[model samples]
Target: MRLKYYIIAIMALALTACSDFLEPDSISTFDTNYVFSNVDDARKGVNAIYVQFGVDGFRSRLSNNMTGNTDIERQSGWTSSGDRYQIWDLNALSSNGDLRQFWNAAYTAIRDANIAIEGIEASAALNSSDVLISKTMYHLLGEAYTLRAYWYSMLTYHFGDVPNVRLAPKAGNDFFLGKEDRNVILSQVIEDMMSIEEKMLWAEELPYGIEQVNREFTLGLIARIALQRGGYYLTPALNMERTSDYQTYYQIAKEYTEKLINLKDRPLPEDFRQVFLNNAKFVTPVNDDILFEVPFAIGNGDVGWNIGVTVQGGATASHNYGSGNNYMAIPPSYYYSFDTLDTRRDVTCAYYIVNTDFQEEFVNGGISNISQGKWSRYYLDAGPGASSAKGTGINWPMLRYADVLLMHAEAENELNGPTAAALESMARVRRRAFDSALWDEKVDNYLASISTSKEDFFDAIVNERAWEFGGEMIRKYELIRWGIYSEKMAETVQTLKDMADSAFEGTGPYADLPDYIYWKRNESGRFTVLNPNRKIAAAPDDTWTRESWLLGLRNEVTIYQEWITKDWRNYIDQGPKPGVARYIFPIPEEAVTNSQGVLANDGYGF
Candidate 1:
């Protein structure tokens, strides 16, 4: 069962609110002594940090809407000039409201965490003679540290080198600050997580389970941020580079992932689909596939609303489930890239929508707009009413055990050239992707092929991540760190063109792929399709309905949709530096105005 700790506890911290982005009159005076004097109040102080996750900044924008234009997940933002479109198109201005919302929310959460951390450290309860009180206090302190690190990690990656505000707000404190190096911020947070993770309890020991941050998640985060610190990043000079001591960070990743695997290990859940179904079903089991997920209440989060399968209905519609649509669509290339027998393919990519009639129907444009199939309100046990669209209450998965295993494999390979340990780690994740019957061919042999060289293994990891975590919205950051964001986007564009040419001309590498698909509901009323992998001369029966598939990629005037061809042009050729993604966004106008000459939007052509 999930707890209402965060929601119920945050109200007490309202009077002690800190200004977003540390403006003057930053911290309103509050009685910190009373709040941290006992274990219960201290827990409330920490819970306030999680309140930000339920806000619009993370619930919709940062989590799903703004993270797009990747090889797998995409949105054609070329036509619209809205705030979200500006972000999707990678040309967000300083005044873009979406960026400002996330920026402000992250800093607000950071400020709350800072207050809790300081209060907990100074609290007399921390050193209480009673074992229970002392242990609980220590755990609360760790929670504060981990939460603060999480916010810093998001801020640095999204805006690049944001001001490092480490102290709790006070009247005399210096609020105005300038950007620090992103590496410095990442390094600091990584160290912060590392310091407290060992002292924190595991998920099973905690009442909230995977719904809240625990030792395992913090340990995994250490490796994750370490890899990010070690990986390539865009510099002020518009160059893609990593620090000379990058290997040190990689070693940190290797050590921490290794530590987690050794001290506390869990097998990847065999049924990948059930992993997400559990989230929608509100069944969060401890020591399972997920390490930590942001626990949004029933009236919060945009999981199924904006990031899952398209559900078309409204207040006046026949169905009571209301409406939801995927802001980011799966590229047909990504859909076809999956192995035909892979179970993850169907679960990760959906070509149908829950229509207004509450019946499954093929998406209007077919291959042009394949929605994410992982989760949807249609899968909910009960509807939230026909007028509902914004919140589905499905928890957003922050980290999974599969990611930990993959990170272990990647870090091991980078440090020691695809060692036996590395191959085993990769194989563990792949083993779950396929069935036991095909393990020898799909898992063992595939691992053997990729283990030929370090480069081959690394490439396999990249492809594996795309297939494993499609629709999860972490692909953009992964590509950036891999220094292949532009290369992959360019490749995706060309692949789309090839797919279009083959379907239009009926003679190319993808000619075997069907131009149109024949689909029908099965006896169980589940949507099924024929010729998903290759072309067929005709449908086997009249029961099947035909729809344009690959053929939909082109029209009379263009080989592919103009949006497809122009989708990543700026990311590939016209960014701040050619062939490099301009990962940094301009500091929000409000933040710049509040900085009092300490900050400006200057680098990366801002």
Candidate 2:
């Protein structure tokens, strides 16, 4: 409850990713006059709002929280405990430490944004100096409002109806405000973003290599917010779904996503892996496909330390990334779910990697074998010896044009089944996943395979999203919105159990052993781990035999076999039933205690 509501946002304007501005936090009295005295001051004020995106508690934790509890990823290894464990394990209490960090961090960002909004508004009359200055101030103010909307949207999504503080808190003001309806808050956020859509510049209009909050990304935010607002959400107190909102938001989501699709030059990249590689390598010549990314710099603030080596694994014969904790991996079922011909299968999840001996080796001594290669730390110049290796300048893509296309397809399927435009939009994503010549044919065959019904098409969209965005921290939310999180999760575990029940014998990693590993480079230029146990007819040419360890356990239970025998739902905390309230987290105990009865765990009153 000791929320330090101050002018910290304004005081830290000079601490940008690149140090070009001045620091005034040392000054006893913050001269408000100089803070907004010119266009540069206004620009600094707005840039401060974006600083939250790189903070330890905000975007970094957000990515982990969103992805950790899903079907595709699990928290294991050295770094998987404490608050994050509470989130994935599901025994999170109102007193959970991370819940407090997330709540406090979000409100801190929101409070600073309110200050920026007020300052920008006060400087409107002073913009009579230059034409460019006037335009800049307006643009800056627009960003402030859009950002505030974004933070509030996040709060409402994670924790139901939170206090809607539109204005900055003043000394001696009543801070114990009551919770407001999440829908009402989202409505205001949408209106605020709409008000400034035209005033802001697009990513393309900005200087090359500069990542900023622009018009298209803001519109994407709008589409995302509207979709949530219109979709089913647990109500406060009862934790029941708002059944009536789905249709309304579906239309809103479709409108905004379609607008994005129609935008000039906002095309999906031909290669999916290339887009990620560009970000990891820090592509000098920036591409337009990445609508928005959180910028980071070594020695300054960065996300690579948290996401790169931590999320992905260490150096292997297949790739190099110095050292990494293989803390998270996809299940065997998810690995086998992908079509053998699909390019995304190998890139999204790699079960086996070639060792130093140029032989396929299980990752992490086979504890948690699979690894995500989306953001490889080795892609950065920082090596194991570099002190800054942990702080590589790899940015996180919050919104990409590929997501825009998929959203459009999902909304269209919901509204009017599979239309031609929707099919083409979805096919564009598949084209990147497969070879060019057969891409269209694969899309046609996939569409034809699904039943010609809206529900069936939505099912396709659900699976497509999993393949398209494996480790991007999006699937859990998608499952919740569709009201199938529990059902689909049960199926996921069942898939694993079925594989274990059959033992390792049929295909993939379970096939019968012949000793030597079999692998091939897919069209995507990534290594695909084929069946490692395959035996072929050869005359004195082949001499590779199974390792002693593998031969010893020929028909015995393996790590994967042991994994399926335990309770898969152990990922959910010990208690807390899989109810609507369980989908979102509980508000921190201190906040509720300090709210003076103003903030109750209405939806999640467990």
Candidate 3:
């Protein structure tokens, strides 16, 4: 019940990565007096949206929460028993100035979008420009709407529900703007995407980047939104009682996912690793597979912090800091998903790390092993001292062909519980983990080599996601969607902690061995123990409770945010009896005060 509702979407926002956006004017001060009269100015407005996305991304730039990354690392005092995995801290609700800046920037861009729309309309009315200019006006107007909707969607995902302020004034506090219903917000987003869908073109054929919102990306967003809304409305993951709206969402998800599956924009890369780079702006110009993603310029672009050192580093790794070290690592049992012959294992990660410097030598989750290859060294070259690092790659996929296929499998599995088609989708991802040659021999050529049942198809999907996406944080969404991540994560973490504890004391501290470690008092070495760095297993700790520890922090907004003050007990059933709340999230407390009249969702924390 103490779990905060704010959860950063790790798998969210797939456009250009680590970019920046700002204009001469600020969102806090808006002006309709100055309107858009030319295509150039209108183009600037659309570009402004991408910049806003960059700023928004900066808020989550550090990590698995707001900065969603797949490489798991331990935070401060993570191994200890006292609230080691502090979930609230990882959530998007941070007091950090960067977060505030990004939030302000998002609104600033939103304000600009509003200004653009108003300005273009007024300009057209006054007959400001010629025929070409008039056509430009309409195009820019539609573009503004698309950008506005996209920004709102991003905000909604991170904060859950927010005030629907469509207009930004030239002056004064727009916080006075009343909150819009979540349903209204979603409806607006859908309308905007659909409107732009007709106006936008495929990036491949498009001449301009700003006006070039890919139709497929918009559709993907539509699909994602439907799923989220559906899950929120119906799934027991949040323990919601409502099921009335489930079927609608299920249908929407099914329809959109199917649409993406058939897209000819691009096919899956022959090399799975190539898929990412190929989509990057620097690599292939634009792979058809990527629907849309935040674009990061090279050199000056925001190369994310050295995630390997930050996420995989241990107690002594200099790159990792007090709060953002790696406690999370790959569970060996999970490794079975990757066939030993799979070349991706080595390419995705370096099984070993050589941190001679004691400071950064062992901070990588204390496991001493790392999955280093998942991210290219280009990202690492960008950061030296600072905890924040954004890589130079302009290419970040927000939506892609592979994800579409997976979604189809997931929606299908969720609706039907599981199916062969879903299993095939899952297998295709896994088979690619091996080298193309090995894959051809073992999987493609041999039909029966990889076969699974309905019940285990999801598990296979999870494995494929983990192995393929690895450090990208895509797996986290899968865990949440399935509603069992907390328990599984707790089990995994406790097992590692126990093994390390036993190894540390039994031997005189881990002997700095890689792989597996065991303690032994050598005959010639007196009482000194021989400690190998092999991964060890410990009995599950009953005390490690997922109910309390599983992802305490999230980018999701708490319904509690709506209430001025609340009786804590109303949200949870936990005391000695530990009763759970019917519905946990309250509208953001700010919304309750900001709305025209006080409004609260039913059964929220009550």
Model 2: runs farther than 4 Å from truth? 1-28, 31-34, 76-81, 125-131, 208-210, 236-240, 284-287, 300-322, 352-361, 365-367, 382-389, 504-575, 578-581, 602-605
Tens digit per residue, CA lDDT, model 3, 239-351:
43323565576667667776655554355666766655443324434445555555554432332333333333334445532112222334332333355676555445433
How accurate locally is residue 551 in candidate 1, as Cα lDDT from 0 to 100? 88
Check candidate 1 and list the clashing pairs. Answer: none
Tens-digit lDDT track of model 1 for 1-606: 775544584565553443556562333445788888899888888888888888888889988888888999988878799999888888999999998899888888888888889898899999999888988888888888888888887787778888999988777788998899989999998888887887788999998989888889988899989989999988878888989998899889889888989998888888999999998999998888899998878888898888888888886678988889888999999999999999999999999898888888888667878999998999899989898987778898998888988998998999899999999988988888898999999999999999999999999999999999999999998998899999999999999999999988999989999998999988877788987999888898899999988888998887578878777888899777779888788888899988888889987878
Preferred candidate (TM-score higher): 2 or 3: 2
Better of 1 and 2 by lDDT: 1
Decoy 2 TM-score against native: 0.83
User: If both were scored by TM-score, which would come out higher, candidate 1 or candidate 2?
Assistant: 1
TM-score of each: 0.98, 0.83, 0.64
Off by over 4 Å in 1: 15-18, 24-29
Ranking by lDDT: 1, 2, 3
lDDT value for model 3:
0.44
The predicted structure with the larger lDDT, 1 or 3, is 1
